[model samples]
Target chain A: MARLSYLKALQRALIDEMSRDESVFVLGEDIRVGVNNVTTGLLAKFGPQRVLDTPLSEQGFTSFATGAALAGMRPVIEFQIPSLLFLVFEQIANQAHKFSLMTGGQARVPVTYFVPGSGSKTGWAGQHSDHPYGLFAHVGVKTVVPATPADAYGLFVSAIREDDPVVIFAPAGSLGVRDDVDLETLSAVPLGVGTIHRPGSDVTVVAVGHHVQTALAVADQLEGEISVEVWDPRSLYPFDWSGLAESVNRTGRLVVIDDSNRHCGIAGEILATAAEQMRLTAPPRRVTRPSGAVLPFALALDLACQPDAEQLVTAVREVAKD
Target chain B: MEASLYRMVRLIRRFEERCVELVRSGDIIGGIHPYIGQEAIAAGVCAALRFDDIITSTHRGHGHVLAKGADPIRMLAELCGKVTGLNRGRGGSMHAADFSKGIFGANGIVGAGGAIATGAAWAFLRQGGGDKVAVSFFGDGAVSQGVLLEAMNLAALWKVPVLFVCENNGYATTLTVSESVAGTICGRASAFGIPSSTVDGMDAAVVFEAASAAVESARRGEGPAFLECLTYRFDAHHTWEHKARVRYRPAEEEVSGRLRDPVEIAGGRLDPAERESIDEAIEALLDEAVAFATTSPAPDPSTALDYLYGSAVLP
Candidate 1:
């Protein structure tokens, strides 16, 4: 058994994919130097041609990746800061995402946009702190937010291999979490699938990215009083609705813990779908950031804005009572 | 040399004139950004490119698409939103593309095509293909976009074989180049240490000579080259002006701008009989193009999302 950190899992996924397929290349600002450590040693192994260090031109390079993908190369772009996604929204959303439909099926932009430090890093205020996985999901781009090291490796590998454009947001909170796993057992996890960490009968706790750990811990703390099922959806868009329905069917109640804003966030979508289609005995609840949240620089303010274990526990208890 | 360049200019001129008539007769919807005055740049630059080379065009793109060997009838059908169009009615006016003929696409966004051309060139090189070159054509307005600057840096850094052609027609939708851009246009490329030159865009021969040298350098793997074609627009930005009445350029200025029409300049090179024959041939082509476009069927609403994804449906 080996303990793999989330960051190391990302690095291993990149190395494995690049070694497995020559068409898989990494491009971003300061990637050759491995500024984020997710691309460590990749430059030395793949060389400059495969591990390209692009200029700080987010729009240009984003579209550059789209073009490369269309021309039969799979490009993985690393964003140092999450806010840079806003700058290249047009490139990814309007250009790359639309290429398949706009070109009469002549093109496939198999580009993977990897954001290593998404969400809040304490003291990194307004500009640096953003979790925009919800935006990608809204635009129907395959969006993934991995919670554990093993899932990180599996989802990233799947995103790279996917024929459509995929956005993998490696949350800052989950980057440090390590998982003890068998090295020989590491394998590709299919997208749009949910993993149940703990099966229970009272309530199903749907968690996203970093919140999965909180849900599991809360479930452990409330062991005998409530039977909690922790469900981690590795991929956000084309979400594992069937898997979620099965979990909810067993538990009969639902609570979604997410680090995004309340309005139009992934949590809202989960609750809405469960209410509309899924079999739920009681009304579902969601713990999320305030609507239109802008995380402040102070540690306390940042913590206050994000969905925490306390909120998850409270929401779980509320859903249980329902 | 001048006569051949003039012939291309005449061809583009008549081609666009027929396209404008198609717009009026409701054959081509969503009126085009007519390339009426800036014909010399497309004519001259495309004249230098081989059939195997590729070009990525812009919104005012019919000239480059046509000059790069797209069939006139198919292109007109595209503008008409017909099923027989280049992209089968999916692209409409702003997104006509014919990859087989080496026209990657005519993008609607400003300054967005440079990196696409660079990436395509990189792919060509990586595949061990011949030293095929790519040309990205944009306007003076595109010079201010940071993405274009980034693309220039990437092209220079990777030593990709591409030619960045900037057609400086002054206005980026009503704003003059002097009012919008801070530094010189060619300076943007020169800043990346890529060899850049400014040529007389109104003269087809000069543009052809400059583009030929740049294209040859790129084919030899000498990295990217940038050419600033100094020209002016002889028509409004869009045909909507025929009804909207948005005035930007002075009336006298417009008259002076159209004075050295590239068609007349290039037409001067051919013998009178040769010029007459070319004119007759172009007219006939335009007639057939208009007829075909007018008769072509519009795309069905049921299959609008036919190309939404490349992969087979997930079972």
Candidate 2:
């Protein structure tokens, strides 16, 4: 057993996958020097052929990865800032994501778009702070957000092995998390599967990415008074609907804590699905950032724009009441 | 060599004309951007390439798809949206692909395939693909797109074996190249230190000569090269323009542009009897293609979302 940080778990996954598959390679800006520390030793370990330092052309490299994938290479692109995803949105969502269906299954792009420190990092401000996994999920690109160190390792492995284009967001809020785990136990965690962090009988809280930590905290605080169940949906797109239904059925109430802004966000989908398919005692509720939220520079303002434990607590209480 | 080039140009011209007819008759649902006058470019460039060499194409891609040796019957079926088509009707006109033939895809987005082709070139070499080159076919309008230019820079930087072919067909959907492009099309590659040349796009032999030199240089590990094939569009930018009557080209320019017809330019090199036989052969082949395209059954609507992911069970 060893104590591993969430960022280190991601790094370990990259090393393991690259060692396992000759086709696997990585490219990004400043990745050679490990600007984000997720690719610290990859350059020396994998060499320049596998570890490429691309110019600051997000659109170019993103589509380049697509072409390489078409030529039978598994490329993992590391985006230093989460919002750089917007610059390559067309390449990933419009181009790579559509290739499989557009080509009638003649091609499969096994590229992993790895965005470390996704979502609000205290004072990064507007351009660097946005979390857009919801956009990829809406476009039907495979999307995953692992909240634990073990899950970070497992899901990153699975994302690299996935035959389709996948966007794996490692939330900034969870980057500092560390857990004591057996190294041998870490393996590929299949996509589209959700895990129950804390089982309860009253309200099921669907927490996304790093918000799983906050939901767990909120559930602990409401322990005796309200039975709050925390469900972490590691893979967002191929969501474990049946798993969500089972939890919602047992608890009889649902509340979602999502990092995305309200309008057309995954939170709204969760609420709608629960309301439509599950037996809920009260109307399902969600705690999300305001619609069109642009995180302000000040620490307090940044904290204000993010979904917090307090909001999740309130949501769970409201949903459990009826 | 001349006869083969003439045959390609004739095939593309007739195929596109047949597609336009199908569009008018409601057999083909959406309109296609006809590759009428730009046939010499696809034919010339593809003639210089081996069957294993890869090529990425643009929205005006039928000529490239046909020149790269995709089955005309399957391609026509694809345009007609039949289950028996190249992409099984999943990709209609703009998105057809045949990986087995090294035809990566005919991208729907403008300027998108350049970077993709460059990356493929880089990987082909890295994966020990000896002397194999990739060709990216885009229009004059794509020269200004940042991604395509960025691709040129990277291709030159890494010495990736890729050929950038710019088909200068005068208009980018009603906007003239003069109105849109600020600099010479070849200058875009020159800025990236990639050797480039401008050729007559209407003369198949001239284009073939330029493309052959560039493809050979790239294959020799001299890095990437570029070719700007100056041509004209003899048909509407898209079949939709027929009804819209968006008159962007002057009547005199239109008449003058048709004078240097690629088909006639290539056919002039052939004997009268040989030209007539080639034309007859093309018409019979196209007749079979059209019959196959129109008679093939439509894909089941229930399987509309079948190939969305690599694993059919992902969703």
Candidate 3:
């Protein structure tokens, strides 16, 4: 067993995949020197051919990845910041994502978009601090946000292997997370499966990305009074709706803590799905950043905009009231 | 070579005209972006490419797709939105692709295919996939696009074998080159240190000669080359413009612009009897294509999202 940090797990996954398949390569800005650390040592191990250092051209490289995928290569693109996704949104969402269906299956864009420090950092300001996984989910692109180190490795593996475009967001908050993992036993986690981390029967707390840790902590704090079941939906687009239904049915209540904006977010969709389909004793609630949230540069202001433990505790408590 | 280029230009001309007719008759639902005057560019460029050479096209793409060796019957069926079409009717006019023939796709977004072609060229090189090069067919409007310029930079930097074909049909939708582009089109390639040239797009022989040199140089690993084919649009930008009456070109200008027709220019080189036979054969082939397209069934609505994933499962 070894202690693996989330960042380390990402690096290991890239190393393993590149070693396993000659078709697998990584491209990003300053990836050779590992500016984000996820691609650290990749240049030395895989050489410059496989570990390409692209210019600061998100649109160019994103679409470039798509093209390489079309030519039968598995390309993983590492974005240093989250908001850079917005710059390449058209390339990813429109061109790469649509190629399969648009070309009637003649093309398979097996490109993985890995955003290392997604969501708000301490004081990265507005441009660098946006978490837009919800946008990709809304557009039907396979979206995953792994909360733990093991999941980071497994999901990154699956994302690279997946024969479609997948955007995996490793939240800034989760970057520091370390987990005890048996290296030999670490394996791929299939997309669209949810795990109940700390199961209970009173209220089900659905958490996304880094918020899964927050939900687990909140569940622990509310353990004596409320039986809080924490469910981590690692993959957001092919959401494990059946698992969510089963949990909601068992607990009779639902609360979601998502890092996205409140309006039109994945949390809203989860709540609506539970209300429409699942058996719920009380109306569900969600904790999320405000609609159109732009994380300000100030330390406190940025923290204020992020979904936190206190908010999760309140949301879980509110859903448990009925 | 001359005869084949003439045949290709003629085929694209008639195929597009037939598509416009189908649109009028409601056989083809969405109107197509007619590649009427720009046929020689596709014919010339595609002729220069080998069977394995890849190409990524633009919205005005029927000519490119046809020139790249897609079955006209299947292409027509695609345009008609039939299950038997090239993309099983999912892609229609703007997104048709045949990977077997190395046609990457006909993209709906302008200037999007440049980077894609460059990347494909880079991968092909990495895979030791021989001297196969990639061609990206875009318009005068795409010259100003940052992505295309960035692609040129990457292609030049890595020495990726890519032929950047810019079909300068004078206008981008309703906006002319004077209104839409700044500086020069070939200057964009020159800025990236890519060798470039401007050629007459209406003459297939001229375009073929220029494209041959670029494709050959690229295949030799001499890096990328750019060709700016200056042509005119004889028909409406899109068939929708026919009804919208969005007139930007004057009557006199339109008359003069259509005079240097690619079909006529290519046909002038062919023996009169031989050209007549080729035209007759094309007419018969197109007749069969139209019949097959209209008769083929539309895709089942239940399978509307089929092939959305590589697994062929609707997620």
Candidate 4:
């Protein structure tokens, strides 16, 4: 089996999809030069027409992708920064997402908004660092945060094929992670399906995006005492709620580790859903960033606010004890 | 040509008036943005367009949609939130659309449709299906929006076949175009090398002539064109304004605004007997349309989210 990095898997998915469907085109700033390496060789392989290089106007190009989609072209837009989503939120939320319902199902805006390295990156602070999958998920936009290389390849392909506007956030942490996998075996992962990374009975630690790997590693380290079930709800919007109920029903305990802000984030939504309807032996715990968190420029301050593996270890142990 | 144009304008006028009545009767839940005085722009612009040509409309877009050939009965039913409505009642009033007729949608956000039209033009340019053009209808208030300006730059740069029709109807909500928009509206388009002109939106023939020239240029791969249609809104911006009684402009503005009515201008171009016959036919059509919409059943509460996504799955 050949080893492929999460970043390479994403690039391969783009290359494969463009080859299979000529309607699949990309629009973004500096994507011709492949700034973040996700669009690394797309321009050369597919030419400029398929690999569209856009201007710095986020609002313009974002709605532009929607227009293209309405005219029978599937557009895949690349946002260089995560916070850029804030600038074009109206284009996605109001214009593109609303078309289907607004047009009485007469229109379909099948555009994929890909954020190459979302959330905090080493020393980048404030505006550059935000994992806003929660924002899209909350607004009913199909959101995917792939936890592994295979998942990245599969989910990206599925998102492009969906008949609605989809947002794929490639976290800053998972981009470099590599795995041993066969390219021929790569296929679309079903949306709204949760994947359990490791099997356990003591506590279910539901992690999203990059934290799936973190939860898996912590489960291995704490194998002697606490048995942790690491679950990743890959598609966050339709949110494998049934799968989550089954998992919580078995473990009878829940803990969510999400990178978004503590207040009104995906973590809060998951806990509320579980408390209201799902089976739970104890009060579910959530490990997340501080309220209204803004990552600082200094490395130390940034790490302090972010939910680390140490925090996950503590939360998992505390939940298991109860 | 004169009779058909007059018929459309009359149909729009009656449809909008009926919609206002529906709002008052509580049949239409949310009050609508009336297209009372700007009927000439929609009639003229759509008259110059082919059936396949696409258009993106503004919040005040019922006239554009109706002119582009949507069924008035279904459109009215949509406003009434009936299952038989054009958008199956999901789009409501502001977002009503019929893609089969190339009506993209009536956008709630100002100036957002220009960029979508630009992108649609790019697709048409790539397809090259013998002169398919896209149009965007916005107000003078949208001239200052960064996205619309950026779309003009992209359309000019790529030579996309798009016609930017700015319906300069004097006021966006309560603020006059002069107070909100800086500089002239045509200046914004010419800065990006797009050929532009300002026409009398009150006269249907004048607007049709301007649109024909712009549409011809666009279809021949000459990039985008801009037309600033000088018009006025004779009624309240929203139906709610009738009760709110907000008076931002002088009373004379309303009195003078009706002097050059588009309906009268187009109707005058026709023989008096032919105009009267068309008027009679339109009233009959609208009477049936109102009956069909009023009799249609309202959507069930359980199916409130049926059309949120085109595909079936959890929201």
**Each prediction's Cα lDDT score?**
0.88, 0.93, 0.92, 0.90
| CAPRI quality band, candidate 3 | medium
Candidate 4 collision pairs: none
- CA displacement after TM-score superposition, residue B192 of candidate 1 (Å): 2.2
What DockQ does candidate 2 have relative to the true complex?
0.79
**Per-residue alpha-carbon lDDT of candidate 3 for residues B1-315, written as tens digits (9 for 90 to 100):** 989999999999999999999999999988999999999999999999999999999999999999999999999999999999999999999999999999999999999999999999999999994999999999998888899888999999999999999999888887889898888999888988999999999999999999999999998899999999999999998999989998788789899999899999999988999999999999999999999999999999998887777742224
User: Candidate 3, TM-score vs. the true structure?
Assistant: 0.99
Best by lDDT: 2
For model 4, the local distance difference test gives 0.90
DockQ of every model listed? 0.54, 0.79, 0.74, 0.78
True contacts kept of 4: 0.80
Model 3 residue-pair collision total: 0
lDDT of 3 at A82: 91
Q: What is the TM-score of each candidate against the true structure?
A: 0.95, 0.99, 0.99, 0.98
Candidate 2: list runs displaced more than 4 Å: B312-314
Model 2 RMSD vs true structure: 0.9
lDDT of 1 by residue, A1-322 (tens): 9998989999999999999999999999999889899887887888888998877788888988877786789999999999999999988888888877766665688999999989998899999999999998888788899999999999999989989898999999999999898878877878888899888899999999998889999999999999999999888987888899899988889999998899999999999989998888888999999999999988899999999898888888888888
